[model samples]
Target: MRMGGLTVWFWALASASALLLGPVVSSSSTTWVADGTVLELDDSNFESAISSLDLVLVDFHAPWCGHCKRLAPQLDAAAPMLAALKNPIVIAKVNADKYSSLRDKYGVDGFPTLKLFIHGVPQDYKGPRNADLLVRYLKKFAAPDVTVLDSDSAVADFVEAAGTFFPIYIGFGLEESVVSKLALKYKRKAWFSVVKDVSEDVMMLYDFDKVPALVSLHPSYNEQHVFYGPFEEEFLEDFIKQSLLPLAMPINYDTLKSLDDDERKLVLTIVEDEDDEKSKNLIKILKSAASANRDLIFGYVGLKQWEDFADTFGANKKTKLPKMVVWDRTEEYFRVNGSETIGEEDQASQVSQFLEGYKEGRTIKERVGGSLSLTSFISSFLGLGTVYVLVFVVATIILVRKATEEEPLRVGRGDEVDRATSSISEAESREAGEKED
Candidate 1:
């Protein structure tokens, strides 16, 4: 133990500490592996609990992971608060060592993997592990309490007031009607208000024609979108859920920046002509995809308005039209659909594949377009042209020098040419004299 220069006592103390703070499992009733408000889960009950509870947060952990031991108490403290919400949630913990298949099924690659199971669908939890944050995050799934505003002026003031929640639904009818029921159903996602026997002016102010009408007002845009209805529960529920999101929100400077800041992938549909059939279809296609992907942010940019913004992402009307892309901030990657044209089925499939690939570190990134791309292309062309031009000029100068230089024999040199001419004249004179003789 003391063979090295330093001591080895830290190991013994750490071992003892782990043993002291470790999970306790007993034959009779000593302690469940997960203590306090958390429920101890096994393979048998894991699926049943998730399917039974409308909202259940599952913690996949092992006894040896240091983070799990630390998170145990935090989750235990947050459990009661979660259960106290309108749509209560159960906090369950599974010992991954005992239930290997369950852990693998849920893709628990790391220690203390937290997954929020909503109606039996599992989604990875990315929020902080602290008790307060866990409590608040889980409580958002529960139906929010409805608040009633007094007087017409009060309604106006309240509607005009600034808040984080958007499209605050104000019901102008009785509390016991279908509106309250709808409010209760969707309260977790949206804010709700009830005005007891409100006036016609109030309804008209919010763009509602009759009593029991539902008015959704957006304070940021200072405009109201009205929904007068059959008021059936199904219709109202569907309307609230879908109406909460604008089908294809235009991606502008603020929205593009926001997309970069967001944790999830931003699926932007760049459509040039908003009135074109292709553009119109994108709204529905994107809406369906958004419905399937509630975790990811969905947006669209018009080719006319936000063309510059789209250009940054390498999408323009001429080359890549009506396409879909997922910008992964974490990986710094971009994946476009394989098909050139955007089809509803193809977009959904490609997006699904991108999401799946992203988890496994398989997303491939390409260059984002700007002046840089054009500069690179021009540089490449000029670089090749410079090489060829240099070769041509060098070859021409070499040929010209070879043709104009003095010859070695009596050909082009000044003295050699004069001597050759004189020798020819003398030979000709001697031949003429001999003929005369």
Candidate 2:
């Protein structure tokens, strides 16, 4: 039998056996620890307990909140390390909804509010996230180290320490974004933090979520202010007082409009559904392409405003729902139907090809290789598995047959028949001798 056939037979038998008893043998379980046993803090124990405990960390949580759910596992894993610390702190959790009095006492407004208390009182606190800063704060004032904290703790303290000259970065949306790019370019020094989801206390403190939000953390608040919005390099260059600053400023829409006809390129896309998965994917690809090349201008016109964009581009929407129109500075634009008709598995491949062709100013040859497509690969794998089982069965049958047909050896002594034959020969010899006499 062939090697492939024997292998296939063994594999098929093993798989069928595994499938028969899989559910009966496998199991998964989760242990839920009693909250009150592990967590030791209550309204009655709060005052006396806080003073005695060296470090007190309280998590004010709710049943709902997706972010809270994601954070819980991390916090739980850290509990043991916290417990092992010298003059260790007690970690406690509180459901704000269940314990309204405690919530009121702490002024808890957020879904998850982590508070660190020193000597039965809430010390100047910051967290729920930002674990590093929290750890540092706890180690400095709350722990036995007696180490002094950073100069910028409170809002007033930050303003006081930041003196006259400071660094500033301006950008829209996520504050944690690359505002520092322009700041580092000019070599302007400043403090920076992006605002995503802020608390009520924080909102009241900042006053407004200002666009072109100028964020500066320096002693010279008056000298540096960052405006977060779409901006031109010329404006940025003119605005900078010092020539020492390096800039990573992005090109604005106006700059692209001023470019020569040959150098300019614009991609206009009509997204019928903003929330659709296909639309999201197209947007992601476009954004990446736009970031990589400055000459490639990318813009999205929502299908929500399809008529306005279609009329302007003279786009044919009868056949295509998600259409793309590309143009130079001329009135006429090259157009294509909705990104290979939506449900394409290789949307990224298609988009990559589209953009590369557009950038070269002429249609490019296909770079995508058909090196054993997915379907063929899967079919080949299954065929090999089948061959292995057949080989295994043939090997097993041969082994069994060889075992059954094997000849057994036997041991024997000289028997009666041999003795009789010898006696008869002697008798015949004696008779022959008498007859001759």
Compare the candidates by TM-score and give the number of the best one: 1
Each model's lDDT comes to 0.57, 0.43
List where candidate 1 sits over 4 angstroms from the true fold. Answer: 1-36, 44-55, 62-77, 83-88, 105-112, 117-130, 144-168, 174-196, 199-210, 217-224, 230-242, 246-437
Q: Residue 139 error for model 2, in Å?
A: 40
> Candidate 1 residues 1-437, lDDT tens each?
11110111111112112011223333332333323367778886776566555566889876755667889999888877765554567788999745877865775534577888876788666556889777755554544456677789878766654243455787777464656776666654566777776877886667767777777765544445566776778877756665565544666533343333235566666778766776767676676666566666678777787565566566665655776666553323365334334654556565455556545665457665643232222222222222223344443454355543322111111222243233333334445666678
**Residue 387, candidate 1: alpha-carbon lDDT:** 26
Query: Candidate 2, which segments miss by more than 4 Å at Cα?
Result: 1-264, 336-343, 363-437
Most accurate candidate by lDDT: 1
TM-scores for all predictions: 0.40, 0.26
Write down the TM-score for model 2: 0.26
